[model samples]
Target: MSKALGYKSFGGSDVQEFFSRPDLTPSPVEVLVQVAAAGVNPADHKLRSGEAPDLNGHLPFPQVLGLEAAGTVLAVGAEVTGLAVGDRVTGFALTGAGTYAETTLLLGAATARIPDALPETWAATIPVAGTTALDVLDQLDLPAGSSVLVNGIGGGVGIAVAQIARDRGLVVTGTAGTAKRDLVTSTGASFVDYTGGDVVERLRALAPEGFDAAVDTVGGPSLHEIAGLAKVLVSVGDQSVTELGGATVERRVDRSGLERVAELMVTGRLDPHITATYPLAQADEALALVESKHATGKVVIDLRL
Candidate 1:
């Protein structure tokens, strides 16, 4: 049996429970993995709380709660040719059969073998936060020396974006809580403390001519406040961006993209930061930190711990 952390019904943390179940079977385009580590995100709690019905509406009850993981492949489906048993890889976990467990299913096309130098904990973050950063930047396609504003630039995806923007030679500026001032500025990006006085005036003073583009991780009012600061706008998750003549980030999940991101990490061009980790027994704690939206960097569950 595989031990897992999951929710029996859509609600609050009270719905989460630990249970044992049969090992998940891979589909024709899937791979079975013995999870060594899993990445935590705000989406996990959102899905568990029934906030994302569009994505979780079809899922069954007692669904496992994780989107990305890294581990050794235990088995591969008949149609899965790129991976073999015992391969160390990372990718998106199959819906319902999540990575927050002893065993879970990863889609073959989205999975990529990790380099020997990359730790499983870091690789586990590539499938989601890492790639999301890449996609948002690629969608914007800003040229070097161009200025860009990263609204809400303290979370996992936000930090990744700032680092990559710096590498690409784009001028980066971001707004975040005072506690994250060091973390945001460490990437060579200018940091704007959202809690200190008027944010709009502060941003205007930094880039009076306005930014070439703005990539928003915080939606709703935060996004609205910064939308006009840049000529181009792109949001990571907010579809409402389209109404403002901006496009939401387009995510492309494939083996090649995963390999490219893994290479960046191997070469030290990208770092997940991964400020916190927890054991499977403390899965809820790991997720709670991420859900709080105040985590400095990535939060991961280390099964090996």
Candidate 2:
């Protein structure tokens, strides 16, 4: 049997129930994995709290919750190629059940080889938010040397967006609180401190003509306020940020984003940043850090298998 985190209730930290399940064997399209690490994301909280829009009764109480992870493929199912037993891989799991398990079954295509040099903890942080960043930026159409303003540049996705945008030759400018300034700037982006009340005014002073493009990973009334100075806005959150912010809002690109970002990571243009890690039993703590809305980089759950 395998130990997995499940939720018998909804809302609050008490929703989770860590329990055991019969050890799962991989099907033809699945790969058996020993989870090395899992990522804690705001989306996970949103889903658990009943705040996400797609619930529609798809998952019920006692359900496992998680999306991405880094692990070793203990065994590969038949009919799969380009992967084998003992491969080091990181990927999202919907087909393998979930990532919050000691061992999991994962969709073959979702798994990809992680670089040997990257730690499993670091590799685990890349798939979900990294792929989302790739998708958002790809659709923004920022051209070489174009100026951009990225709001919410404090976490994994924001940092990825800043770096990818810079790699594409854009003059990337970003927003982060004072404490997270260094992390945001580490992505080689010009930093904007939005904790101050007059950030929009400051931006106008520095860039009077407004940015050529914008990304809003933090969706709120404030996002709309700042985005009024941008020509186009990309998002993975509330669309109202665009309608009220005066910039075009797009949801995402496509599934191809994951593979594309992996290429960038391999080429050294983008790197995964792991801010903090908690043990598997401390998964709840990790989730809190990410959900606190203050994580400077991706918060991770180390399975330590």
Candidate 3:
């Protein structure tokens, strides 16, 4: 049996628990992985809280709770190619076969081999946060030296956006809570404290000409407040940004995207900045930190911890 963390039904964090299940078998387009590390993101808690409708149409009692993982390939399906047993890889889990387990299934098309220099914990964060950052920036396609505002620039995706924007020669000004001020500024972004009153007033001081583009990682009123600051606006946290004339992020979850991120990491241009790692048995605690909105950067569950 393989150990895993999941919920029997949709609810709150109270519903999460550890359980055991038979090891998974890879489908024709899938590979079986022995998970070494898993990433914890807001999406995990949101799904468990029933905020998002079931994507697979039905919830298998004890639905797994993670989306991305990094580990070793234990086996590959007969039709799988480019991966072999004992290869190190990172990937998105197959629907219903989440990464929060000792063994899980990864779609072969979405999986990429990890560079020997990248640690599993950092690689685990690449599939979701790294790709989202790359896709959003590509969607914006701003010119070099463009002034961009990163609304809510403290989380995993936001941090990646800041670093990549800097590398791409964009002038970045980010709004984050005071707690994350140092982190946001370390990326060379001008930091604005969102908790402070009159955010627009502060933003105007940072960019008198106004921003050329904006990426919203914090939604609701926060997104609304900053929606007009830029000509090109994209939201990663909410789809409602579309109603305000902005579009949601363009997501590309494939081996090519993952490999690109790995290259960026190898070149020292991108850092996952994993702030905390817990053992698989302590996944709930790791998730609680992310769900609370207090995590500094990325939180990961390392099986070896």
TM-score of each candidate structure, all chains considered together: 0.98, 0.90, 0.98
lDDT of 2 by residue, 189-282 (tens): 8888987778889889878999987788888876867767887776667757646654334433222455566677778888767778888887
lDDT of 1 by residue, 46-115 (tens): 8899988888878888799999999999999999978999999999986677889988999999999999
lDDT (C-alpha) at residue 266 in model 3: 91
Candidate 2 wrongly placed segments (more than 4 Å): 53-56, 77-79, 241-256
lDDT of 3 by residue, 1-305 (tens): 99999988888988988999997888899999999999999988888877887564376777888999999999998887899999999999965678889999999999999999999998999999999999999999988999989998999999999999999999999998899998988899999998888999989887777899999988999999988889889999798998999999979888999999988999999988889999998999999999888898899999998
Clashes of each: 0, 2, 0
Worst 10 residues of 2 by lDDT: 247-256
Sequence-dependent TM-score of model 1: 0.98
lDDT of 2: 0.77
